[model samples]
Target: MACMPDSMRARYDVVIVGAGHNGLTAAAYAARGGRSVLVLERADHVGGAAVSARPFAGVDARLSRYSYLVSLMPRQVVEELRLPITLKRRRYSSYTPVADGGLLVDTQDDAATRASFRRLTGSEADFEAWGRFYAMTAEVARRLAPTLTEPLLPRSAVRDLVIGAVGEVAWRSLFEEPLGEVLRRTFADDVVRGVAATDGLIGTFADVDEPSLRQNRCFLYHVIGNGTGDWDVPVGGMGAVSGALHDAAVAAGASIVTSATVTSVDPGASGVEVAWTDAAGRTRGVTAGHLLAGCAPAELERLLGGDDAARPGGEAPASYPEGAQLKVNMLLTRLPRLRDDVDPVAAFSGTLHVNESLTQLQDAHAQAAAGRIPDLPPSEIYCHTLSDRTILGPSFARTEAQTITLFGLHMPTRLFRADPDGSRERALRATLASLNSVLAEPIEDVLALDAHGAPCLEVRTPVDLEGDVGLPGGHIFHRDLSWPFAESDDAAGRWGVETEHPRVLLAGAGARRGGGVSGIPGRAAAMVVLGSAAG
Candidate 1:
């Protein structure tokens, strides 16, 4: 624990703990609304999992270790914030390599994509049907984006009525319907169906063919932006996006303190007392009218003294069943060689879903659910070098290309017996071996692999237990996206940000609408406070 500065004793309107993207956004909005705000971060850096790290000595590159892609971010936030777009922004184009040496690529251009699908399935009608299904699903995704990003409390009379009407109209047709059936109705081609189902299965413990899994369609709202159908990478790296947000927050009159770990939060009647430690060995406390937590709900619970200290749950927190994600980042001296028919550039530009059949994906999920690492996991690889040549020197002379490989539905972090030290190395080796099998030459010599298991991730980014990079369930969309809103405390949207605890509001990803870099929760919290004062 470090000491606080002698001059840092002023009382503020709000105190925010954690400087992740969502936290930063919240701070920015709170400050803009005429409230003095302070942001505390445990790590020396503030990006959380959205950071750029130098994997190899003297090599400067950005890598999104836990979260590798961004499409779910709202376009409104990007425009209002005027975020920089230097990174190689590409759509979420995906390629699934078949065991028979064939490839299926999903593209935004419906006709061209249909042509490709027909080539793979040998049926034009099937291909066209797949296109229509995606188009329709995308429409649903667009409609659902608002509900996810903003707080949807139906507790108020008018709000409840409005919500009821919307729910009746939007979900009446799809309610209780299985996601696979929805896909089946949308696309006749198995390849098309597999791609749509893949989106629902990844990052979740749900089966692709399960009933009512169609709720996952809201996650696809990333497609709402640009309608281009590709997941874009930030220029320079994922860190650039967070870096920009941090700068924006600072510019908006918010002060950020890095390497500051908040140990306890005592919620008083009117304000909250926050105890934190800085880099140097010292203890300090700060009082604020409102306290917004951007860390995990569990971490917050622990900080507030566990269940005994927590206010009774208004509703049960959404169930984010324990699951694990294994990420392997590799620095290769030479570009990986693919089959003659595959374009290395296109393969690396967007996300590549390997072993991408419905059965393969489901089996991996099953293995993960059962607390076992799949022998052949379904992996998604993004080759940064192919898409952004700057990652490598103009001619690849001394430059090293980076690849981010994600292995989902594998080894549950809670069930794994070995320490992360050994587990990470083993996972990296396994991933490299798999890549080696597909490459023309041995890649062992050029491989500079950095593997992250549960422990490493917990240390680097503690928000995974909360289930998301946005701290407390990487669900950037937050409570708004949780299903069956009627049964959860999240449905009330009375997230304490605007209640009688006027001085204290919940601003982090754990608040009202929940996570993401959108900064909506932060802005909303500020608005609530400001509007109350005005009234």
Candidate 2:
């Protein structure tokens, strides 16, 4: 209900809900095609969950709070939208801690990687397995990634494509079994297995051996991004991506009104009626030819007419799809000194993994599933300031300041549901302590304090994510990210964003092949609207 007052157009060709990155993309595409477009956002700004903002009081740093790093955004969208964003790849992929020196996956040098693994694991078995596994995955990614932008491929067809690329052994081991089982079977060392398995549990919290293979879905998206699976750093933080999309939207003649939270959407044969509340609590309404639910699919259904809001296709939504990750953003005065002898800059530049050996990750999941927060939460940390100093001000550059984003895996939303406030405090304590367990000194030692003398750290629990970002249960993908292939006959031939309603469509992460800040669903949704006009 909180919003700034702005006069909305009485009629438009398209009315897109939720002015997040996806919404903006849809608006730009729709308007560029000569359709009168209106974008309605609930928040005070654009970039719903993918925004970069200053969290701490009196801090000059702009941190990527919710969604950090870029891996899945396609070059096609960037070129088409004329997005002015630069993504940089880390020379080192990941570093895992062990007894003496940690295991570092240096992307630039295979000899360095081999030396690190051989020194840490005492053999080249897992490293060899790691190479073979990625090669197979790379082939699968090459065959599958191109299919995402087209009409949904049948699951069997996609399976055949994977089999054609990687053969029966990989398909049975990777697609059939749980990702944890595959990692366990492939690698000789526990640390190496954990490193590979971490990809499967990024935004998901489940046993690697869980029968559902939800972990497999997560793993596929993590690696298949651009087919190479390399997570890259945005040169000027995540805000650059959002800002560029916003510019493209504006240039395409889309009217974006912020602080305008959409309250209702009614679809009809003729046109759709959209209603909302302004900043002063005044009610307002508008109508558009086509309605795009640029928010979560479930949120769209809720806005469709209150009690009459039927589930799309009458399929009941999941009872409680909870996101299982904790995002912690901190402005560190200096990088923490690691137990390993590598320079702090080199150590923090890549994924600085903590307490995520294969058995240890499984133990954390067991503890969390049993309703107790894991004593030592599994997490991965990286320093954005190391790659892009633009996020920090001149003062920061002079002081060599750094921004560290630590994402703790396996912390589900259910754990914090009962005691929301207390759980955050306890979870933050546990996660920080878990992090300190791996560091030479407490991480708090080098943190820049706020004016109030509190450490410049902002902890966003699943509860906070659900509350602030309008993500139901703080589920980052809006719901479980579906396999890119089609699940139903109705959705097989059309754009993935199509809805049961003739004029309503999904343009957010809830759509199939929707996750991260990729904007694939937005592009798909816009194609649906524009395609109808051309037809």
Candidate 3:
């Protein structure tokens, strides 16, 4: 237990559990609203998953360590917080390699994209269908994205909003049916179907036709980012995004304490008493009128002296969250040559799908579910340096050094739970092999060496994420993503960040409209607290 700071007050208007981006966002808003706020973070620094690191010793590159790319963060939050953040849109949407050539969707050149589609599929029909499918999603994004920052709409109302604009069939395809089924019915090309389906399976470990429709939920969040679903690269890497939020929170008079690990949470009638250990090995306690949980629901439950199943109606407690992906970060001396003769720059700029065709993806999912690593792992890679060179040091900024992030799907926690290190090694080998299958030269040829003479590459498995960042089961979304709309009448018109307790609210990815890098949950929680204060 940490001893309380002598100069600090014993209580505050609000106390946040973690100093991640969402926690910072909530603290900024709460403090700005004239409420005394204190943010406790276990880490020595802020920014949980949304951070950049120079993993390789003496490497000149600062790579986005976890949760690369940004889309769901709203401009309203940025403007309101006055955060110093810059996001650059990607020109190429994605490029998938086929046996002969490849399919490259260039946002800047429609003709080139169409020609690339034709070159692969031998027609423009797939491209037209791609346009139509995205057009429908675009409409849904336009209508639904704005509602994220507002109160939760009833499921019926949100359905009407979507079905009215996009037609019932489109609505059913997106919200009701399995994303894999929808992709199969919408796109003819296997590569095209794979490209669309990849979004749904991003950190979610589920087949396209997963009966629970988890894939659909994941897909909905992916495409609804501020109405465009364009994943942008943060200028200074993910660290810049969290750094801005931290600065804004501090500027708003929020007291942020790092290396303060919360030990217990005592929620009662008057207020919640939080016990934590400070950096100096002393325990401290603070009382708050309201508590915002920026940690995972499971973590909050644990702090409340409960297990996963303790909170029955709050968050579904039947199954624990399980992350399904392999994250590999690499600093490359130069981009490797592609087999299809496309410029390595163009191919790696956007998402480079490697062995991720629809059939391949489905097969990989099947193998992984059967307790075996995919023979040919389905993965995607994007070069961060192409979009933002500021992440590199001055010496490497003008050189060919680049940062590559590869996210391999279908590698669930179960595969590594028994043998974390061995399984991770096997998964990394399989993932690199998958990427090499599409490249003219092996990726190893371009590997950058750290100052210690080791390869400048780091691999994080699901287990690694849990140990490294306290992600329960390493689930990136904290848990499975929920539909944005209110599921019942009781939830209608309420802020989706509410918990079973009156004084506690969720301010992380576990809240409704909370997944991804968006701070909607943080804003919603603050609004609820402010509304209660005003009342």
Best of the candidates, TM-score: 3
Report model 2's TM-score to 2 decimal places.
0.95
lDDT of 1 by residue, 1-535 (tens): 1223335566777788777777777766667677777888887787766666655444444455555666655666667667774545664377665544444454656666666666677777766665555565455555545654444545343234433545542242244466666666666656556666766544444666555453353334334443343466666666777788787777777778888878888887666888998779577788877777766555566677765322221222445323344555666655566653666666656766665566666676687577555656666677665555544434342454555545444344443333445654555555555555555565565555434321111122112323334333333233323341323455455433443344556665455444334455555566565555421
Q: Rank the candidates by TM-score, best first.
A: 3, 2, 1
For each candidate, give its TM-score against the true structure.
0.80, 0.95, 0.97
lDDT of 3: 0.89
Q: How many backbone clashes does candidate 2 have?
A: 1
Alpha-carbon local distance difference test for all models:
0.56, 0.84, 0.89
Reference-based lDDT, residue 250, model 2:
80
lDDT of 3 at 499: 85
Query: How well is each residue in 1-535 modelled by candidate 3, as lDDT tens digits?
Result: 1112335688888999988889989988998998888899998889989989989999878899988999999999999999889999999999888789999899999999999989988899999999999999999999999999899899999999999998998789988898887888888889889989999999999989988999999999999998999999999999999999988888888888889999899889889999999889888899989999999988898898987443322333547788898999999889888878888788888999988889999999999999999999999887899999999999899889899999999999889988888999999998998888888899999999999999988999988998788788888999999999999999999989888899999999899887888888888999999988631
Question: In candidate 3, which residue ranges exceed 4 Å CA deviation?
Answer: 1-8, 308-318
Off by over 4 Å in 1: 1-8, 104-112, 146-175, 188-191, 209-230, 307-321, 389-402, 415-418, 429-505, 511-517
Ranking of all candidate structures by their lDDT, best first: 3, 2, 1
RMSD of 1: 5.8
